[model samples]
Target: MIGFSDTSISKIAKRASVSAATIYIYHENNEDLLYKTYLKIKGKMSEKMFQGVDHTRTVYERFEAIIRNYVDFIQSFKDYFLFLEQIMNSPLPQKWC
Candidate 1:
């Protein structure tokens, strides 16, 4: 697998068995694609982090539950978790805020 820095739209298209033009139809550019992918994964992670956590519970309890959920998410989606970490540490994260 190519690292994020080495990946290109054509590579992604080829892997997905689609044409480069098809990828362009959905993403304006690679940066846009990465941004969207980051958002998608973050959304899923957030969902996991909040799953079954009672809002009415004490702050400590909620925090603990969220941490547990985060651990579960990391274990279940290690690749996604690593992707998120990589993106978060990159300059692209500035665009997110």
Candidate 2:
């Protein structure tokens, strides 16, 4: 029941019947939680992409399979993609820019 709102932490706490401080006990901050979520989503995407990739396949076939998997992953996680797009487009964090 994770949500993608600015108040995601608050919503999560409410849904889980816990105080926001309880979440902070596990996560340092909202940014850390977001990073963890991103890592989890990326891991799942990678696992699905590599699920049945054949090492013996032709280079072109393997490349196409990877590309298709990537495209599907992005398509399936459109909200996350949009969040990334917003971050990339924003003028925050000079390192990222």
Candidate 3:
């Protein structure tokens, strides 16, 4: 994959089958796009990580359920998980988190 340093708005827009102006219609700039994507993926991961977690269950059971759900998310959406990992190490998190 092309690293973010080498990526440009036009390149991303072309890859996404949209024009650069189209991207700007929703994002202020490249960093905004990346930050928004990070938020979206993080929301998805959070949802999956707590899905079907029963509050009525014992503490241990609840913890185990959360862990299982997280494992399932990582296994089923490996790309999203990896993206999150990459973003966590980037400056975007410091700027937005």
Candidate 2 per-residue lDDT, tens place, 13-87, comes to: 997999999999989876677666656666777876776778899999998888887778789888766655554
TM-score of each: 0.91, 0.64, 0.93
RMSD of each: 1.4, 4.2, 1.1
Q: Is candidate 1 or candidate 3 better by TM-score?
A: 3
Per-residue lDDT, model 1, residue 48, is 99
Candidate 3 worst ten-residue window by lDDT: 88-97
Q: Per-residue lDDT tens digits of candidate 1, residues 1-97?
A: 4567898999999999999999999899999999999999999999999999999999999999999999999999999999999888888888667
Query: How do the residues 17-91 of candidate 3 rate in per-residue lDDT, one tens digit apiece?
Result: 999999999999888888888889989999998999999999999999999999999999999998888888777
- Cα-based lDDT for every prediction: 0.93, 0.70, 0.89
Clashes per prediction? 0, 0, 0
lDDT at 86, model 3: 83
Model 2 lDDT-worst window of ten: 88-97
lDDT-based ranking: 1, 3, 2
Decreasing TM-score order of the candidates: 3, 1, 2
The best candidate in terms of lDDT: 1
